[model samples]
Target chain A: MAVPEVLLQSGVSSLLNSINSVIQSLGVSVLLPIIIFLIALAFRVDVLKAARSSILIGIGFIGINLVIGLFSENISPLAQQMVEVTGITLPAVDVGWPAAAAIAFGIAELGVWMIPLFVAMNLVLFAIGFTYTLNVDIWNYWHFAFIGGLVYMSTNNWLYSVAVGLTLGLFVLVAADWTQPAVEETFDTPGISIPHGTSAPYAVAAIPIHWAVDKTPLGNIEADPDAIQDRFGILGEPIFVGLAIGLVIGIAAYSNALFVAESWYAILTAGISFAAVMHILPMMVGILMEGLTPLSESIRNFMTSRFEDRDMAIGLDSAILIGHESVIASSLLIVPIAIVMSIILPGNDVLWGIDLATFPFFFALMVPIMNGNIVKMVVTGTILLIPLHYISSAVAPLLTQAAGSAGFDLAGRGLITSPVADAGSPATGVLALIPAPVALAVGLVIVLGIWVALRMWPQRMYMVAGASEEKARETVERRHTGKGGGLLPNKLGSSADVTAAEGRSDD
Target chain B: MTTKNILVVCGTSVATSTVVKEALKEKLPERGLDIGTIAKAKATEAPGKVSSGNFDLIVTTTQLNQDKFDIPVIHTTAFMTGIGQDEVLDDIAAALED
Candidate 1:
């Protein structure tokens, strides 16, 4: 009887192990879609729509994996050869945000919980009047997951990861509130605030920098946005940028074999391959967004219906601000500067790649804070890129670890990091260093204090940030009256005045 | 019926533009518009795409220098915030008809 019982137990244990292995083999491509499907159904989305969107998400993941495979296969060898030939020790591949987003969502343990966690947090905050900004930009929720995944990778503690992720979410909401006046003034998008993880944190850093620059002779120098756009606009084009970098790196790597026909073929292929990666990766992400749209719309409807009558700001992606001429000019100027700095900046091992096209996002809020001063925006951006390199290098190992766990085939590839959202983030980099418990404590205090302060003196904060008395009063009055802001007919009717206001606000 | 090509532009081609594109795909056909390919590009790449592609209407969620393009540029964040979306759809339909 005892022998038969032992045999039965062993058989059951083996069966369970097989099931676990099978689930693991399915990977994020299949699993993430399952998770999304469940979430959409829970949100009461139509069954057919839920299935379709979730499958698109699965397809998006598969498409992203294919692109990363191609990108790494080509770029990894070139990066290795370049390091060998040029004697530059920069081995960290900047895989850009597309891969970063996939890795963030691939963490099954944490990714499954991120949507519910943030949505609950937003609902709670809005209920308590702790936050007036309803963050409906569910697609970018990957930022929090990325940070949480990093903490989880390091500490192996889920609790700590949750704490840090929630802390960052609160901090971003407050940053959005603090920058709302400037964002609205600069972008001419009233009633909208950018609580974007990549863009908002930079605005906090820029306020002091903008202030310091104003005290110097550099404050008076203004660069013409039209001239900069006309002169350096080609630099902003991804195909050109990719081809140029690929050719430069290819030539440098194959310098010893320049006479060989094979070397030139490799060089030219590298150029076109990179351009394809730049152009195609975002297109894949668009498909990912297509899958996400139904769910995102459901969440937005859920949140807005709950708070329809409240006076609040709608949080959105920073993409809305990038069309400003100053943003276009400053970002164009920063692309070359970033490349040069990546090579020369000491203690930096990150080889800047795909995220170079994302310079516009980094400068979006900063341009507004600097009051569209192209010179100041460029100067501050160059100065900030120094710390950005060091932070990216510091976090590259953890990012690589997270990517591996996400089932990215980083087998022979060296360490990888993203410049814009992953390593370059001050919030993620700084919080990652401290012991998780201590970091959680500090983060809570800071976020809570900022939220309370912003809630109490919404307009005072704007005034302190340099809004004129009249403008501040007008903002407060607008908030009180609940009249012209946030999807109102009166606001839409003043389109001509808003256009005229854009001209006056730029100077 | 000739399919009208529409170009959607935003900061990142992947972010807001995708949102706008999905909204258009769902809403355009309901309004009796023959939608062709809805191409997406970053705001900085808008000019190159416009000059190269035969687009009948331009819709953007961000500010574009409308002066640079002859096409009627419908710049609005309505699709993103789910506000005044019908009005913007009406505008797009009207522009495509012209």
Candidate 2:
């Protein structure tokens, strides 16, 4: 039901205005930590500890935002300059994840209801034993909103938007449960699972492909960074690789630099910047994880105390997992590849504007799915992102429309494209390209399939996480014993023992 | 007196290395090991990095090509997982003494 125009005029408008003002004034960095603190208090955490964790979480967000800001500050201009120099107008300006979030939250029709609706949905699911991932990363709800806004645009019905949004939430919760075992096993992070907007859907897409890849003789080959280093030596180091890729992108981006000196400067700066980004971004991730540790611990304690039989997984931002080596290496390598994809892929109309920050977010799960195989990740990442360009290009018109409706001033900009929302997000593309009713029907099938899968093969659903525990132990042992050089080891154990240990998530 | 150089390697040289770096900073002084330059690099970068033959020891959480690095290499997920940390520290001290 559409909220009446008169009601929107009165107390509702004033209330939402007041809330938005407060949110805008305090900034997300300040607001999010405070919210976390309040949530911790509600959980009956000790005041001092809660306060510390909240502040630290806030600081972590600030650090991440600052790094993103730094990255965008350097790269966004380079991207725009590339467009200007190359005269390659792709018909959509890639506003990126942050701008996409702004468009999402700014929509009163969607933003006003997303949090309450999802929280209620989460509770209902948990009560019914459908999902165990307590999704506390409310800030990322924009991802859901982005999809709903598209559905709404397609159907011209607010109800469809709400339905799709709620459905997406339900899907993510199920996806979280399905992937938890892998998360727990792989990252050695026992109590947490990622229900991140970008990673979960990609995880679903990657599953069958990974299965297929494993079937091929290519599956017998192991090509993680360590293996690649063993094979290619210096070319395998992320720094050198990033340098070479960045130089190519920089030269291409600055192809029309007027002076020879200016062109050289551009090439050198881009090379160094890409190298620095690959190196430093993980440090920022480390800081972010440090802040989250206390809160995760407290929540783990509180939940375990309540449900002793259950091993609850706290769903967090996918950013936490990106600190891994394969994730960083894959994302860094794919940066140039994405640029090349945009240039070479025929019928592609998106110039991959400012959404460059979303690359690491994109690879959050793919790296793990590839089992830390850098070679496989790049191959899969390229294949996965290729279709996204077309998908995002198709949705660019609707996205721009939604942004315009959300009170954004896009008077001059011709067509705005969101790399993440368009093709970058598998979920959004599914919602945008398919008719609303058909999409909803398909969504139902998938959700039901996932639910049944969770019931029948709860252990198998999280196989990635299952293998992680062994991987972790082996990694520690091999590294400690100085037995590092060789082809990648096969799946360590044949027994059902490790999968039995994965039985902890049965609750 | 030669100042020993230590290279701390993690897969990304980010999260795990930070923890390992902190652990070394705390333990090395107590173990009577004077640190010179403690640097960080990705595990994949270890071979090319150490090829200069500059560092005295390599501490990493990921597997590396140990034969390529002439220096003593110690592998422990101790900093991240808190398992076998003492053995790692003891080895670090022994390597430094050597």
Candidate 3:
């Protein structure tokens, strides 16, 4: 009996070991999908649908890895050569948000916890009347994961990383509530707020700049957005921007062989390659989003159902605001401005890359605050880019480390950073400097204070920024009465009172 | 079967637009609509793309300056939020049929 019992124990132990080895070998690509599958089931998604979505997510990760491999293979050596030829000494490469998002999602430890924590916090805030924004923009949750991963890499503490991530999430919710009015006025999209990490926090920087500009003649100088869009629209296209940068870098890097046909061949090849990267990288991310959409929608439905009676503003991606003419025009202008600033700015070493396309997101919220003044938007964006460059440069090593651990082949690639993901706002930069413990404590206090203030003076807080008094009062009333701000004109029957009235009339 | 071309426009062309495009791909065929080529573009590129490409309709999750295009524009966030998605899909099918 003892011998048979020993044999059974050994067999069970070996089975467990083999399963562990398989998971270790597959790493994040497999593990994340498994986690996602389980989470989908927990959220009550259909079994077949959950399986397909999870598999698609796994495929998306594989696609991202393949594209980053292509990106580094093509760009890294050219980047090194460009640095040598131009003597720019900017060793850090801006890898864009695709690589950044991949890296963020790749960190399984922090990524797994962020979704639950963010949802719980949102619910708590909503329950207490501290916030009226239900942030369903789950795709942008990578911003929290990215920041958390950075803190984990810096402090090597799981608790610290989670704390920092949660704090950033809180800040985004408040920023969204504060900026809803501006979004409504500028974009003509009602009952919507942007809780995006990249776009929301910039409102802090733009508010003071808007105030200062109003005191000067620059505030009145309104550049015609249509004319600007007509003239500089080509700059907004990624293929052209990529081609131009590649050709310039090729010429600079291969200046010694300018007379040789070989040099011309290399230059032209580089141009097309760069353009391909610019075009293909986003397509890869699009696959990731395709896999993510169902999951995000499931999560959104799960959250919104809980607060059905509340007058909550729908939190969405800042991408929704990108259609404004002022945003497009100013973003087009900021492209060249950002490139030049990266090169000439003192104490800055990060080179701009694919995230040049993200300038529209940066300027979207700021444009409305500037009252659609293109000139003022450009000026404020320029001012904001200075610190953005510095912070991006400072965080390059940590970003590189995080990217490497996420299975990105950073073999010869030196330090890497993202302009949009790494240093999208000064708030992230400041938070990165504080010790983890202090950040946790201070971050909690500040977030709680803001929440309390918003709860206490909802109308006043709404009017403090770009919102008009009437709009503020309406929003406050809607939240209290749970009756107005319907997305569709006919969907106004959502409120219980209205439904009751309709039922009585029918009877 | 007449194959209809569609253009999906959004802020980044990478985020919400992809969701809308995926939904259309899944739902349009179920509604007996044959889809030809489904293209994606940024909001700023919509006007240029519409004039240049032969598209049957424009489905967007974000705000578009609809006055710039002669093609039918259907703006909805149903795909992103998962509310009223069936109605939007019906709208798309109706638009394409016309």
| Pairs of colliding residues, candidate 3 | none
Error of 2 at A224 (Å): 7.5
Which portions of model 2 miss their true places by more than 4 Å? A1-30, A45-78, A90-127, A132-169, A176-197, A210-225, A230-246, A253-259, A270-293, A311-337, A349-380, A392-423, A431-441, A454-507, B1-98
Residues A1-507, candidate 1: write the lDDT tens digits.
899999999999999999779778999889889999999998888999999999999899888888999999998899899989988778888989888888888888786578879999988877765666899999889888988888999999998888788788888887886777777776788889888888876666677777887799999998799887978665669888888888888998899899999999999999998899998899888888899999999999988899787777889999988989998888888888888898898778888789888888788888656778899998888878887888888888988999888888876689998987757877766677667888788777877676555544545556544455466557655653334333322222222232244445644
lDDT of 1 by residue, B1-98 (tens): 68999999999889889899988998999988899899888888988889875987899988999998878899989988988888988889999998
Q: Which parts of model 1 are misplaced by more than 4 Å?
A: A1-19, A455-457, A463-468, A478-507
Structural similarity to truth (TM-score) of each candidate: 0.91, 0.61, 0.89
Q: Looking at model 3, give its docking quality level.
A: medium
- Docking category for candidate 2? incorrect
List per-prediction Cα lDDT, in the order shown. Answer: 0.82, 0.65, 0.79
Worst 10 residues of 2 chain A by lDDT: A482-491
In terms of lDDT, which candidate is strongest? 1
TM-score of chain B, per candidate?
A: 0.95, 0.90, 0.96
**Residue-wise C-alpha lDDT for candidate 2, range A28-92, written one tens digit per residue:** 45665576667667657778877776676556545545544554565556656666878664666
Q: How well is each residue in B2-25 modelled by candidate 2, as lDDT tens digits? A: 678899886445445655776788
Q: How many backbone clashes does candidate 3 have?
A: 0
